[model samples]
Target: MIEIGHTPAKRLVTIRVSGKLTSKEYDTAVPEIEQAIEQSDGKLNAVVELDDMRGWDIAALWKDLKFDARHFDDFRRIAVVGASGGEKLSSKAAGALTSADVEFFLRDQVDKAEDWAAAD
Candidate 1:
């Protein structure tokens, strides 16, 4: 499953991916992010929390790639928080989805990730 949220002021997007993600999830997520991006005036920052992420479905993978290619410039920064060093590659992979500055942090460091992602 994939869940999308935002800061109270709606300037920052927060994404949580758990279990296996499917195109259906992205179906909902993409629009929400797009709205947030538009609301942010094309310079949104995001924090993606990969919790119990198994991986993405083939269709979700394709959808994600397309979204990234379309909105790479809409992002200002991305912070991918994972639970372990094994997720470093996943974080890097997520970063490849945009031109924004991306960082990886362990679960314990999520506060730092959110702080960095929320900054200007």
Candidate 2:
């Protein structure tokens, strides 16, 4: 499952992922994000929290890649909060794929991640 929250200012978006992610969830989540970016005229930040998320299905992974490629320059900062080493590694890999300044926070530092993502 995936949950998304956005500020009224539309400058920052928060995404939480739990359990297994499927294309269905991405279909629901991605459009809101894209709309947020459009409303912001391209300046946006993201904080993604991976909570007990096992992984993505193949179709979901494809959607992820496509979204990343399409919005490679859309985000100003991206903070990924997770509890596992693999998640940290995935954060680094994501940094390499986009222009955003990407950072990884331990699950305990989610507050810090939110602060960073919301910073000017």
lDDT per residue (tens digit) for residues 1-120 in model 2? 999888847388999999999999999999998988887745799999999999999999999999989988989999999999999999999998799999999999998998998888
| TM-score per model over all chains | 0.92, 0.95
Every model: Cα RMSD to truth: 1.4, 1.2
Write model 1 residue lDDT over 1-120, tens digit each, in one string. Answer: 888887746379999999999989889889988988888855899999999898889999999889989998888889888887778887787777788999998888988999999886
The runs of at least 3 residues in candidate 2 whose Cα sits more than 4 Å from the true structure, single-residue gaps closed, are: none
In candidate 1 the C-alpha lDDT for residue 5 amounts to 88
> Which pairs of residues clash in candidate 1, taking residues 3 or more apart in a chain or in different chains?
none
- Which stretches of candidate 1 lie above 4 Å from their native place? 8-10
lDDT of 1: 0.86
